[model samples]
Target: MSVGWIRPVSGLAASQIVMDDRIAQAEAPPGLYRLDRNWHCDRIWLQVRNVLGIPAPRVYGWSSSTDNPVRAEYILMERSGGVELGKIWHDMPWEERLEVIRTLVGYEKAFVSANLPMHGSLYYAKDLPSPSPSQFLDSVNSIDKGETFVVGPTTNRAFFDQGRGSVEVNRGPWPSLNEFVHSRAARELACIDKFSSYPGQQGLFSGPNQYHPTRALKVEVLGDYLKVATQILPTDANLSKPTLWHSDLHSDNIFVDPSQPTRILNIIDWQAVNVSPLFLQARHPSLIEFEGPIPEGFEPIILPDGFDDMSEETQHQAKNLRAAQSLYKLYEILILRRCPEIAHALHFRDTLPGQITGLASSIFSDGEPILKGMLIQLQDEWATCVRSSIPCPLSFTPEDRTQQKRLEASWSEGVELMHEILTEVGAYQGWDGWVNHNNYPVYKERLARCRENFLDRYAKTEEERSQWIQAWPFEDKTHSPTSL
Candidate 1:
């Protein structure tokens, strides 16, 4: 399994990094793989972190390993003293929030600037099982003269999750963006072939509206995606360039010294960091990401024309909403000023975001309609998007589009309802049915209420109520039946 390095780390083997959570009936979750991923998380990105010039934990002694008395791994480093920013984010005044924005812009700048060559996780040479060059010794850019580090297979959980951790598949430190993205279809195919049952389009709302996908349909979608993706992706060759991203950047992960609350002390939880193509990595930090509509361009923040005539509660809500919109716009402005390259990437994605999203489409995605829609979009746009002389590999009928649009609309409606419920319950980001221990009771009660409300409003008959109850995602799914 992958091991944590003093900084961040990643590896390329399913046995080395992938894990399964369905434990009651499935094999034990790969504890070693988690250790491996955590070990390398920050270490691999040390150079970029160095670029930001942020103070990081000083490693006195560290190793990429899973061998020890505890049968796990740990990094021995000098700790930075700071409280989690999440604890006081809301309490921070406007000026402090602005400072937070500026500081994070610098991070965003660094994330976009650093150029790595391969699409994989970084690992120490010694940590690999095989010392031979044929197995693990390949990196276009080594961190040191002696080449202590090497780019290995990705530790992205998509490769390892479910029961696929034990299966042999190409978990690569891919040499090219095409190879990296092309692996999506192969990966799904491998999972379908290896596992008896696979998780098909799972989500909180998707549960009550179960999509019983077929093996043949899954294969067909993957085939279409593989063909169309080959013709339409990388949108820009520059987007093909590998860039490292910390995917998760919530306030809790960014620590601040209590004495200087606005100053970032350290960013933690560096596990699962992946060096992906710019198209995949191009996104604002989660802390800066907004909900609902945000203003485009660097427009000034202002209240609605009749805001003063609103009720006190309405005014308060309006003020909060305006502030959120303003902050997100400000973040964009900061990007434009400090990191124009990043700004350009964001603009490119905004205009043709589907190309990037569609690049990730495959059999194992949420639903057939979404998958089919992406493939269809790619096929439709090939002439204008790719400008390829060759004919496109896929097409969809008007009937297919009409039917898929209805399904997509239903999916969106379900997502919106689930999102409202999530906000009400204070569910963890993208939470399906599971919650952390500290919030189990509150979440359980809230979820039960949500389920009841859903039944009252949508469950048309006793059979429907029974179906939804069985499909309610908030319940513990660890003990649920599994196919893959």
Candidate 2:
């Protein structure tokens, strides 16, 4: 098992044993070439827990080698003491929920205020290939035992994906935020040169519309992103400061007391931490993310005019949504009061440079159509894209815009199909024509039926039906756009 229970040193908390068993994973790297730095990934993250007052499970003991009796690199932690936030959240009164939101935002304020010297993951000084104990001894606060944590090469998977894992790329404790972004862009550029031909990301969307996504299109869009990176990156010292952030802060990770509902005991799953500039790191936490109307700045949210006329169920859903939106606005308001730079960075997503940098970060996964659409929109709204005298660097012809429209439509269908796969087919972990032994026969039969039904209902002609069958996602010879 990748996870297990452990005995905590303290009687006040439970224990959680998380093990990064490389040998157990189906896709672990070859032992001969796997970097030693990677073995410390799960353990080194906790270095900040004590310094930042982040109430996560403490790492009692850990190892990066598999020579021990257990034959694995494992992390033992003091598990959180309280119940999951999901258990008591929806059932609580409005005041209790607000308190929870306030507590969560308070912790975030601490995170944003921490201005570190570089962008990278935390590692012990001695664990590095060439120990530099004297250099980064002050990166994070020292442990009580005199052990030091150092800022080292980032363990972010993006730098390693698509066969770039062991290759010499600038995965770094980047001295500047701009350098971090440049290195990421450069890595993606290198991948494009190696694997240029990728089909449009249109898998699993059971739809008839199809459009070709090209490497040329990706290059054109990424070039504009590069222009933003090099020339228009925010120069404000506050925005450029390398900060540590927890990327996945959801309700499930947060634990609260069942007796005193407002008390948050601890938060779990801090493994997806990242060290990037504040502009890229600021985002609404998953707990407070809402689909309802959100106002500009710290504006107050008002109930809709027809709330009294709506159905009971609709009104209930609307009230819940409004509460969630209030939580979102409250988070911004709290940041504005405590750390205004981070608050400003929160709204930076709407600006031209922000959009470019934001979209560029996920370009490899987001693919062609979305990037092309952003470029076209920016070009069309040139006057508003940039507030200054600098003209927009991108221009596309009408024909290019028209093709982008088709690609967008196809991409939307693919997205909807992916949702269906997640909720309906239970492909939540991502399916690549594979299923567990117990479900293998059942999935195979269901897939055959789905193929026939899709072809019969959606295919325009005999040739189209044949092509659709050949391109089906859950079968032999499945295609992956980002596969190395």
Candidate 3:
């Protein structure tokens, strides 16, 4: 049996613990343990613990360089053992859940108190990524495979300058929060065109296609829409100060006392924590999100004055419903009063996706009408709260309406033709793994030749024939433009 090392003050043990491949446990004296893992700036986890003073495992020492054998490219720290908060989220009573939310809110408040002078990921100043454009883009690309457009997990300070028309205006670790917001929105706009050009996003049902119609009219117009939207955002001095935030605050990252759900033992996985806009950081802890639609109109859930008379289930449901809403409201109230620039920018930007969907509804039948209705609500909110003086740019002109109606007709015809072709080709059977197969390159080459041949026989240009190819449902196909 392994012996436990105890600290006289806290009475916690250093015992064998299992973590993922990125980290491993060490056999050492009690009160001190080593994390044997590859070294990276993600070790900023220790810095976070030190700064926030959350009741996390204490780090005695760390080796951020692979060369250090004693520091072992890892941290020596006290161990924390507790039930994972996620495992008990559903089982905890409403009162317990409420307490947890309050604890988390306090944690967030502490996080905001530590002001960083720039917008970027947390890293030792010496260890920060070089401020080169290629290095910066590569860093953003490294965060995840599927999501390429979002800015994150990069330490390059110069990567945040978004001027206009270009993806990056200046290489900057932004000095003010206002410029960071401007740059972030500008970067998003620049990504729209780049996202469209991605080969993986070339198909009709590709991620970009799902976002906006592939045609130029919808794409170009939305870029204009984004510029107008960004102009109305807040750029106040207080709002521009950067603060640290845990961007991904899912339940698994938290561990709590098994007996008292309200007590957090530790919070881990601080790899990508950012020092950026508070609006970008605030969100309800994911563990407590209500299962159904997020309620609208922002009414605070008023608990009745009657004392503790409700049944357990009713109380639990009420708490669950109100928790996310209350947190959202709290964050909004703080931003509105203290950082109105961010409040206006973040809230207004949230509605853009729904508006984009409304503008590009011809691509998918799923929830288009609902999205359209939501867009109306978002526009009204934007007008009332963001810019009551300026005419809402999102309001459709008569020409805009006519243009979309015409696009809808053509889109309907195209989709009908696509379905007919897919059915004729028998694509619905025999392949359940088109997306995951490793031999996609071999398959893709054959597909290119097929499309080339089709265009040669019946279409004037590859661009025209490519539309039909985009609509093809199978990884296997040789049909030409004439078939359509």
Go through the candidates in order and give the clash count of each.
19, 1, 7
TM-score for candidate 1, please give it: 0.78
The residue-level lDDT of candidate 2 at 421 comes to 51
Better of 1 and 3 by lDDT: 1
Per-model lDDT: 0.63, 0.64, 0.48
User: Could you give candidate 2's per-residue lDDT for residues 10-126 as a string of tens digits?
Assistant: 111111111223323323222211112244544444554666676766554555777754566555555568798888778999888878877777787778666465888777676
Of the candidates numbered 1 and 3, which has the greater TM-score value? 1
Single out the weakest 10-residue window by summed lDDT for candidate 3.
Answer: 7-16
List, residue by residue over 1-484, the lDDT tens digit for candidate 3.
Answer: 1223321211111221223222332344566533534233344455456556765666666676656433335555666678788898877876677677667767766666654556665443345534333212222223443322122344432232211223444434665554655554445444444443311221233211223344354345444445454444344444434666665566776889898778898876554455665545555556555465555556765654542788888777776666656655665565556545555545533545423422331211122323333334446576654567766666655665565556555445445544544443332222222422344565566545655554465455656566545654445422221210
TM-score versus the correct structure, for each prediction: 0.78, 0.80, 0.53
Which stretches of model 2 miss by more than 4 angstroms? 1-45, 66-72, 131-146, 161-168, 196-209, 296-299, 377-403, 416-452, 475-484
Q: What RMSD does model 3 have?
A: 13.1
Whole-structure CA lDDT of model 3: 0.48
Rank by TM-score, descending? 2, 1, 3
Best-to-worst lDDT order: 2, 1, 3
Which clashing pairs does model 2 show?
A: 14-79
**What pairs collide in candidate 3?**
5-30, 157-172, 157-173, 158-171, 158-172, 158-173, 177-240
